[model samples]
Target: MLGAPGPSPAEEPPGGGAASALSGLTTRGRSFLAAGFAAAVCSYVLGQADLLRVGLLLAVLPLVCVAVLRRTRYRVAGSRRLAPARVPAASETRVHLRVDNVSRMPTGLLMLQDRVPYVLGPRPRFVLDRVEPGGRREVSYRVRSDLRGRYPLGPLQLRLTDPFGMCELTRAFSSHDTLTVVPRVEPLPPVRLSGEATGYGEGRQRSPAHAGDDDVIPRGYRHGDDLRRIHWRSTARYGELMVRREEQPQKALCTVLLDTRRSAYRGAGPDSAFEWAVSAAASVSAHMLERGFQVRLLTDTGSSVPGPDGGGGLSGGGFDGAASLDTAGLLLDTLAVVDHSAEPGLSRAYDVLRGGQEGLLVGVFGELDAEQTGVVARMRHRSGAAVAFVLDPAAWSREGPADAGESEGGLRLLRENGWTVVPVAAGASLPELWRAAGDHRAAAGAPRGGAAAGHDHERA
Candidate 1:
């Protein structure tokens, strides 16, 4: 996975600008003209013919070299990388650049006109004084981003010129570096959640039904276990019976799935309901990642990827894409590039995930389909999977009729059927939504969190 993303300074489309800066250099040229005119005027005013001729030669000679030097002299190249691809809100990141001189002639006065992504605004630009022939240098810049999202670093344009400003060359460089900023995760205070979802997981062997789920490791045997868990061959060899006990279900592997079927937008207003759905997914995933859960993301509006294991979990460690601060960035980056599918529903993906309910899954969708609802119902009956919905009230605004698109009622329907419903208002923060969902469980005497719980409650 660490095969450095894209080309470095050594590779990429060779700098292809044909004197764009020189051709459009009205100001710099004007300065040159003004200086020459002053020299000529001064020479004439002082009756010095020699001085006038020298100024004319000085200005015109460099002007001619400008066009020619742009196509030759030194071969300049550049590239950039954002180390620790993922960053926290209100944090800092390093942007690295690799500059190389591909030609024999040493390159000097390299002015880089990098087209940085609008997000990382270039208040202060990049400047490379000199790069020796056959030598390369890596330069770094720091950016402080306040917003959370995935941003493209860019196709940087290397603008080079000689000391006299006579000859100039322009080349474009590309970097696969992308910055992903994730929302701050506030840890849940000591609390507990009610129901089998939270407490039932403690000290229990892998449930027979969930044994097939991926990521569930098997521990060695113990006495008084079911006959099915006994290892017969080992008993014959070692003269002692051994059985396999299921390891405790890991708290890391959490997946968030968002519903993006177009039909869910029936009654929305200014902001499309789809955007709210994405926010919900981002919020929940960010929260879980902060809590040390191995987090993965899935959204119907964009591409759906099951986040990798151990990498993004709340275990407090580095991630090689699977579990890292950039995990959220990659998720949102994929989200940014992915468009909503026109498919009728999410039945197929839900069906596939039903039997493999290994990690925690949070499904968010704007509208509810029968097939999707049915799958959720089944997963609940068998695996005790936690289900939460981010339903939009706007779907009823311009819906077929005022009563036709009511969301609260549909949300209620899911709750009645035993699915957890988090009534998320539009424009709400993801952490806020989780708090709301958690508050309800607390009110009903459900285990809200684990900071404070009894011996049995500590399992949460």
Candidate 2:
């Protein structure tokens, strides 16, 4: 989403003077003025014509330049464009600026500066010699940021000066635009969910004896029912038009539960273990959405992440004037701004998911306590298949590794109860983590096993 540009450099208090409204003389101009005034005053006191002439000349030059600058007209328009408007984190993006002289007169050398996020790169500056009426000048620069978020790109600043360089004028174009940096989505090799192996699929199921709910389960074919979804075998047996309902099944649905509790994660800023959790969640959500599963991203607070239109939920809003919501983009956008919650968010997440069962439950979490571990264990039991990417806060500690036994015990609990758990450390390879999760799918269905079936318990 785009936000308004902040107050420009030229903006000042209402009753400000001309000096405050515009740039004053350069150092050289001030130096000349001081020397001229000293010489002029000395010449008058000593009655020396040579010193008087020199002082007058020096002083007059700057005044002439200022007078000329006062009459100079500045009528120009500028526009900025960002190439590949959307990009993965840490990738380079191109920013181009075009300035056109719209006035009748030609302008002299002008300075252009474009402000960008500090993480993207240094602020870009350029020089244009001249631009005649209807003339255009173009400037281009590249920016890349390691973090994912929506950043404003423009509100170009232009510095105009007269030929003598005595007086300067600064104008700011308040036009603003945004650059969206989405999280990196790593592709996982084909992995079969445990429920898929257990024969839970999209095949027809026996309808309830009462009737089918129109908003949810499918019922017998009515007059306007589409024939394509008709279940011929059920129709033959019941001697009625048995149409397959389009209700979402536990097997066809996947929920990405993200732990965003501030108290649970360690370290700080974008490089913390919390960020790694966000990246992992984004990658898994994207992969599942691309695989055609009905995926939803839920925070530990039990609230769905805001979608493209700034609304919550998968079916709530669309972005970029899209006719339908783009699930992958929405998930990434939500992850871009996710912050740690003050309270224990996992409890609320468990409360939300407790009423309904899920197909595949993939959780990206930080260190959990005993009560939180029990909640996750209950969730695992309700889901057909469950996978957990657990971040070890001890790995983020600089005071050497703290006691990991508690965290280990939590992971042990999840694994003992048929949860595929992968311990994640800071800066761990996401593809490897995904592979580990895939390798342990068998363990998710195993009645009793170690933390993972075949994979070793490698931290990070």
Candidate 3:
């Protein structure tokens, strides 16, 4: 998000009056004024004209500087630009600030500071000696965050001080810029994803000449119908113009589901099991999109990315050609700020999966109870191929590893349902697990279930 225009430095003070001007006096300036007053009192008691003159000069100088600074109309504008506005966690991004002195008068020493979140690092500060009339100055700083989220930078604070350092006034611009720190995406080796290429264009043949009359599907002729496509036999029988319906190619679909229930995972911070799942979801989404598969990022609540139909699902309309990159970006951006949901179960995810067409399902989940396991078992029926990365409770549990027997039982149930299951432990290698999934699919062959149970001991 970009910042909006704000009040100018000179006009920022309330009513631009004397009270505001007096409040700008620095401690040193106030001290001088006090000393000057005391000296004037002593000089009057002793009737010394030289002492009186010196006291008067000391008292008036600071006041004079304040009055001059207050009357000086300063017109300046500030703009902040972020390079690579969206960055991966623990990565650095540069922020460029441009300050334009639009006023006719030369500005005095200026101190600039930009506000930033503590996680991103300390506030950036810069000092400029002066900006000649109608001059501009640019400065930049770098910020990095280990955590992922959106952070606001700005309301750029400017401190204006007199040349003599007698007074200092602080003003802040109203505009603010936003920086999105997204989850880190790991590069995965290209392994054949099972069932991802099962759609019409990839696996099925489209032929019109080989089809009999019954196999030829036709629709009413429209204004732009090609004359060559007219089916004379269907037209003659129906007594109306009919055109052969073209077989539209369908892109393979991939849905990346992330378990975000607060009770599902253990630990906290960047190393938490939940964070790991988020990163894995982002990686898989990008990988599938690059492979030209129509991808959807679904959370425990609902779809994370909206489709072309303005619904909460990915449409098949723009998954091909140049729109793939844009889709990948939108998916990553959504995952960057995804948070844990309070929902206690995976029912919502189940419904979303049930409503969509069967394709490839990739899930990153935490510990699952019997009810949750049952729900997931039902979900497998809706996908051509399903793979699940279930986090090991023992790896992230604060009390220690969970019961191994319970974990094994859940994995067995998913395997029985034809799902390729991979157990994720602390510090697990995502790419390695990804490759293992492909290996499991190849070993399983025609049927994708039961065979994966032999690999249950394998952990990544």
lDDT of each: 0.56, 0.71, 0.79
Per-residue lDDT of candidate 3, residues 103-220 (tens digit): 7888998898999999998999999879998788999999999899999997788788899988887777877789999999999887765676543222221112221222346878
- Cα deviation at 375, candidate 1, in Å, is 6.5
Q: Give candidate 2 regions above 4 Å deviation.
A: 1-17, 21-23, 48-54, 196-251, 269-271, 306-325, 398-405, 425-427, 443-460
The C-alpha RMSD in Å for every predicted model, in order, reads 9.1, 7.8, 6.4
In terms of lDDT, the best-performing candidate is 3
State every prediction's TM-score relative to the real structure: 0.60, 0.77, 0.87
Q: Please give the clash total of every predicted structure, in order.
A: 25, 1, 1
Show where candidate 1 strays beyond 4 Å: 1-60, 63-79, 88-108, 119-150, 174-176, 181-191, 194-255, 265-276, 286-296, 300-304, 307-339, 358-361, 369-379, 393-405, 442-460
Clashing pairs in model 3? 394-401
The digit string of per-residue lDDT tens for model 2 on 299-379 reads 888876543111223321111223124666667777877777987647777776776544577898887889989888888
Per-residue error for 20 in candidate 2, Å, reads: 4.0
Query: For model 1, how does the per-residue alpha-carbon lDDT over 329-361 read when each residue is reduced to its tens digit?
Result: 556565543445686776655654554445555
Candidate 1 lDDT (Cα, 0 to 1): 0.56
**Model 3, residue 231: displacement in angstroms?**
2.1
- Give stretches of model 3 more than 4 Å off: 1-16, 198-227, 238-241, 307-322, 446-460
**Top model number, TM-score:** 3
Cα shift from native, residue 335, model 3 (Å): 1.4
